[model samples]
Target: MTNWTRKALLLSVSAAAVAGTLTAAGAPVAHGRPAEPIAPPLAWGPCEPIPGTPVPAGQQCATLRVPLDYRVPGGPGVDLAVTRLRTDRPEARRGTLLVLAGGPGGSGVRRVAQKGGALRAATDGAYDLVGLDPRGVGGSTRANCALPEADRHVVTLRSWPAADGSITENTERSRRTAASCARNGGPVLGSFSSRNQARDIDRLRAALGERKLSVWGHSYGSYVAAVYAQEHPNRVDRLVLDSTGDPDPTRVGYGWMANVGPAVALRFPDFAAWAADPAREAEGLRLARRAEDVEPLFLALARELDREPRESEVPGVPLTGNLLRQALHSSLDSDAGFAPLARLIRSAQDPRGRPALPPGLAGAIPDEDASVMMAVICNDVRWPGPDSGYAGRVAADRARYPLTAGLPANIAPCAFWKYDREPKPVRITDEGPSNVLMVQSLRDPATPLAGALRMRAALGDRARMVTVGQGGHGMYLGNGNACGDRTVSTFLVTGKRPARDSHCPN
Candidate 1:
């Protein structure tokens, strides 16, 4: 997940009074409900933009009240922070387009602020771009596990095995984390599941007074969008699932996590090629003279660090093998991250040089951010119990995929998470309208092309996937692939899709 600064918005008065009745399946109950299904009107005003992201001139913000628990719609509520940028050319406007952010903890309000202008221009002002901070995200009602500072660090939170591939410490951390969340997070944290996020989007839809919403969901958001499309088939207009993963209901987030080791193996060659390029020598960033040599060099450095960690710019935090491994995993997400990663590797190799850790690796994340990231994954489905042979799996995975060092198959907090009350994950099927489109990169470190094929197959004829001959996590307005970007933009603006599944050569 990208590091994002939190920006809190003021809660509106609409939250004080319940406005709609929702069923367990997220649909509005009609006959038996005392109140109509209509959502309360939003009170739009200026947005309190995130530090680095400026809200566009016409962008407006509002507060939306959704149920704290869908099963008890009339009980306590949580406020979602929403943002909208209406089209400048209203005459040519197609409809409202919702932009869903990734991470399960990603801030959609910030996403709209960062990408709204480019998206507006890309579609030729065809859509009123809109986004929201799902519960426990930035600007929305939050839940905290009050976890220890060490446990909140990205490397630790990811449950990376020790240098020796022993998961003893990882297991302890996972159990403690699960206990802390259950003790402190209460119902708000438990409600941070994908299905609840989908329900929140539908609430946002009703609040906007739009009969149907066109969606652009990225990463984890793609799964939430798929769940929404499955639950409310008739309410979707056009859907775009970007950088999606396998929608296997039984596994859900666990499946995504398990695929990461192999995905990194698939994507590492791209970084290796870039690091070995002749042009990088002029920039003083070349890691190896040949592409194949880069892997051994990295593995050797990591093993050395495991034996003797190097001091880093962050005073208390030394650069260890697992930290280096985690950094590599993150750096593989984009080409822009290559140079910094190469520089860190060079610094680590120097006996007297101190490496400057990437911001994400340098410090512990916010409690709220860590809380949502853990909650969503753990709440969505059941993971193997504590005695389910995680150490053996880690050993096998580490031998099979050294780049990730068995981190993907390692024990997570979900293993200790209480699953007695959690609902089964929603299955993504081909039952929805054929308006769905998936844009995927051939080599995505987080969500590989192979997993994307699973999503495409599950959607069957209901979806058409555009496989870009690129390597990264996100596509369409990202990665600067003109062909892929144009295809998504054209589909959004004119509703024209490719004749069938197609590929865009790099």
Candidate 2:
């Protein structure tokens, strides 16, 4: 029933290219969590197709019924949106490996189709690739805030402060937003927490009929995978966490935002170098004659925008300081994005030039995505409530991390969020298999090396991490060097992770 063809078309663009083969083991280690016999095979069938996308040649889609609430297994259930790209090399297939997408809001069913080929090539066709939309995301059951179109805009959804450091506006907006979510957001919204996402993953494993599941998770997905492994350690065969987060329970979104300061500071040099390069001159995007001058120039530009908002393609929506900051925040996530940001800075600083707006400034984030991104972080952990508490933190954070200013540590709508965490946060421990392989970038603007180190420390000897002396979020064929990619691919395919933690030279 699925629009297999439509799905395929959308996925082909994002999927990685496949290459040479690598042979590896299919069997799990004997003494560890004994592999239980595989469950009864699922009667795989055609998926209800999404119009305008193609299903992989042999892949199919099915709905996995999971409890709406994990604590009550017999309660009403929701259908987890799922898809599979089976291993072409069945003889080499070990088991099904599920891909957990980043963003409690990210769609994984689409991600598999995008990255399937490269992933298969990475593991040498050793496992079937699969993914799903967590509850309250696309193609799964969903929830919406009924938020105003203006508030749904990305710039506003993230809680950018007023042109000045005055968060008076942000504070009022945060309170109203919290009230809106509590009002219009329903039962499914409450179910968007990470705990239930982990439970849904386990149900998906059972539905797939696998004795054990390997995982490749990115960004927020890394947090979900970490929690999953903690809750169901015996169910995991191998795990790969890329672009992880701080597992600190005390300061959920607060810590995540606080981290952005240093994360951006770490990433600023990358932009500076790119902006100063003579090569960027051809694009009329060079910002500074020297690399080191770029940061100060940007600080000046932000101050300029703060004082006099510049009009762009989006009428009435002048480029504000927070918008510029958010732009920098998004650009640092990937290297490919650096040039555009450099160009923007160049245009903004040009005396006679009026630059165009960056893509989607006026566009609306889908209602469901808006709800989950805010909900998951707020619902998973608590946030500080007092405005004075945030003011003091912001002032200190701004002084220490000028690149991100006080943004990372600023208050969000979560401060006014109604629902408390449903359960204690899952604490990642070193009690699992020795099959996990972590790949991280040294200067990731989103998930910094510092946090990844926490995850590595938590996993202890149960894992081996390959720290790439490079910058950018998402590693292992995403932003990593060949040696780093080779290391992770080797572990995924062969089950031979690093004998110890190692570093990949820049």
Candidate 3:
């Protein structure tokens, strides 16, 4: 669920953030189809540091040219910015490991730069780490819907419903956003779909001159990775899917959004416990003496802000209930986000104090970034039509899960998107080699355990799952659980997974 909202908020906090058959003429043939030209070798060079992301020392960069549409192999292409951090000990290097960053719009090049060093150490220099900026992301070819500045804000983009659970505003926003993208975003935007992304990965693998590739994918990337594995099962080796969601082809993106409501309910207790701790008193961050009181306090504050939005640090953007709820969703991703959230909550509770908006909520996201995020989800699967009784669903969801306030069920830009008639999403199955390993947090605010279990079930014998007794997204090398990290790291390095499904204590 590294959708626009989560991606934007996470970025604001710290400024964070395949196989082929062969043919003559260096082209690959697939399933009796005519041969398609293989991507040319990438010319690796010194990587330029991406703004707000540190490039690891000695990381090399390159670009791969992939067709905008695979069906038109000789058509205009898009440039994929690629990065690699070669292992220091090439003597022990096994192969190349691709880092699949989360988000349909996540920058894999940035992810490689950020995690290369730690990953190298974790695998004991067993593989060269490499990643690429998926199309419409980072240094790759980008697209824009010419969205209004107001439409680009994370809160607005997320389609948060009105305080009373009315989705009228959301419906209008979704319609216009869809219209804007259709009117402004050309074939480039239309080309951004998960299947295309999976095809892009195969092109990346070929460009790297590897017959097989291992992968480490988290969040939405896990879904992409799974699709790639399903599409090209024989080309994958030592796969690790971290914090994945259900891969219901009919409802790929919609299912993910729907899961957020239940997921947040499960993960909020962790934050409530932390916020109610006696130790937080010294820091002036405690919200309640009892853990049970924290949820009510937060809900009351949100409702109050709903009726009367409070002024925020951002001059023009006031703190509305949806914005506060958005902040809570972002904060619940990790324990580290608790303090800033607590501070914001405390400030909001004060009569005269002005709340400081999270960076993601302070302003609009870049046009291209927003475009890609919207395009991929909308393009992947057809969403419910405007007449799908979204209002009734939102009302029911709001009553069932007050924490999310019906946002998860509200209509989104996808509901009105003009899809390019792309084929349906591939259904993930247990057809692949049994070389996949999965590590999931018991309480991921985004991906959630229920969805992860569905993914695990879909993969069946093709994978083994390690459920981490933790509460956060990204299980490996994230959320600070040694047991989960070790399980995934060991699998990546040694190709030895637990005999079956296992649990890792926090």
In terms of lDDT, model 2 sits at 0.71
Candidate 3 clash pair list: none
79-152 per-residue lDDT for model 2 (tens digits)? 76788888989999999889987765777877776678788888889999998988766577777777787776
Error of model 1, residue 98, in angstroms: 0.2
Clashing pairs in 1: none
What lDDT is reached at residue 319 by model 3? 94
Using all chains and alpha carbons, the TM-scores for the candidates as numbered come to: 0.94, 0.89, 0.94
- Ranking 1 against 2 by TM-score, winner: 1
**Global local distance difference test of model 1:** 0.81
Model 2, position 443: C-alpha lDDT score: 91
- TM-score for candidate 3, residues paired by index: 0.94
lDDT of 3: 0.81
Candidate models: Cα lDDT each: 0.81, 0.71, 0.81
- For model 1, how does the per-residue alpha-carbon lDDT over 429-451 read when each residue is reduced to its tens digit? 88868999899999988878888
RMSD of each: 5.6, 7.2, 4.9
lDDT of 3 by residue, 415-465 (tens): 777754544887999886899999988888888889889999999999999
TM-score of 1: 0.94
Which stretch of 10 consecutive residues in model 3 shows the poorest summed lDDT? 15-24
